[model samples]
Each structure stands twice: as structure tokens, then as C-alpha cells.
Target: MAKYHRIIMNGESYYREYRYGSDSYGEMLSEEELVHMLLEEVVDEEIEISEREIESALRRIPDREDRYLLQNYIRCLERVGRE
Candidate 1:
């Protein structure tokens, strides 16, 4: 079987993304984290995303602070699924 691991959690992500297979995946977002990410990505209308589509939306955000915050949320959310 392919091995998957959690690198970090609770709003702590060491990189911009994580993947174990063909598609990109990340962790869940807190209510505040969701609001923050939406605020950051509001300028873009071209991104087609779904569900816990946190990281994809985040990549479009030019601000490192917003990316970092959302990345952390991804780590937390993804970790739960893998665990």
C-alpha cells in the first residue's frame, strides 16, 4: 500500500501543498480560517474549487501571510483525514 503521513497539524503546514496520489489534498479549515481564506481569494473569480478546497484557493493569494495562515489550516484538516 502507498504510505501517507501527516507532516503537521493545528494550522501548521511546512509547505504550500501535500499529495499522496493524483489529486492534491489538504486539511480542514477552522471557521476563522475559512473566512480568512475567502477574504484573501475574493479578488479572483477564475478559480474553480469545491468542498474543503482550501489550498487551491490559497495559491492564488499573493500575500504570504494569507497563504501561511491557510496553509496551517490545510495541515490541520488533512492530518485528520489521514489519521
Candidate 2:
């Protein structure tokens, strides 16, 4: 039989399916590992959102603090996407 693990991290839930196999096949990933995987997946997905969309959204912000925060966020996203 197969097993499924459900984990919630940063307000998002992820499900991992594990198939039964020989002893040397593979081991189940830890919760931290799952969370890291989920975060990476999210980053990859957010990176795919159009740059124009992000710029348009950033331009809508009226607060200087919020704009700076968003700009820094976009920079971080770009850096991560490049890796």
C-alpha cells in the first residue's frame, strides 16, 4: 500500500504521496524537508508571474514604505529565480 503525508507550512498545505517499495528504495522526507520543497515550488511559481504584472501592482502602492518593501521583495524574487 501507499502512504500520504499532509503538511502545513506558512499557511499553505502540501500533500506528498509515498509508494511502498523495497527497503533501499527511498525514505520519507521530514517535515522540514517538505516545507523547504514547498517553499521552493512557491518561489518558482511566483517567478513565473509576469514582470509587467508585478510592476503594475507595485506602481499602485501609495505608501513609500510599502513600495520599498515590495521592491525589495521583487529583487529577492529575481535573485532567487536566477539561481
Summarize candidate 1's per-residue lDDT along 1-83 as a digit string, tens digits: 22233344666643223475666656654555655665676665566647556556788899999899888887898799898
Model 2 residue 39 CA deviation (Å) reads: 16
Find the candidate with the highest TM-score and give its number. Answer: 2
Give candidate 2 regions above 4 Å deviation: 1-48
Looking at model 2, residue 32 earns an lDDT score of 74
Error of 2 at 3 (Å): 12
Ten residues in sequence with the least summed lDDT for candidate 1: 1-10
TM-score, cand. 1 = 0.32
TM-score of 2: 0.42
Instruction: Give the per-residue lDDT digits (tens) of candidate 2, residues 1-83.
Output: 34556666777665566555633333456667766765776664443578799889899999989999989988998899899
Backbone clash numbers for all candidates listed: 5, 0
| lDDT score of residue 59 within candidate 2 | 91
Give candidate 1's whole-model lDDT: 0.62
Shift of residue 45 alpha carbon in model 2, Å: 8.6
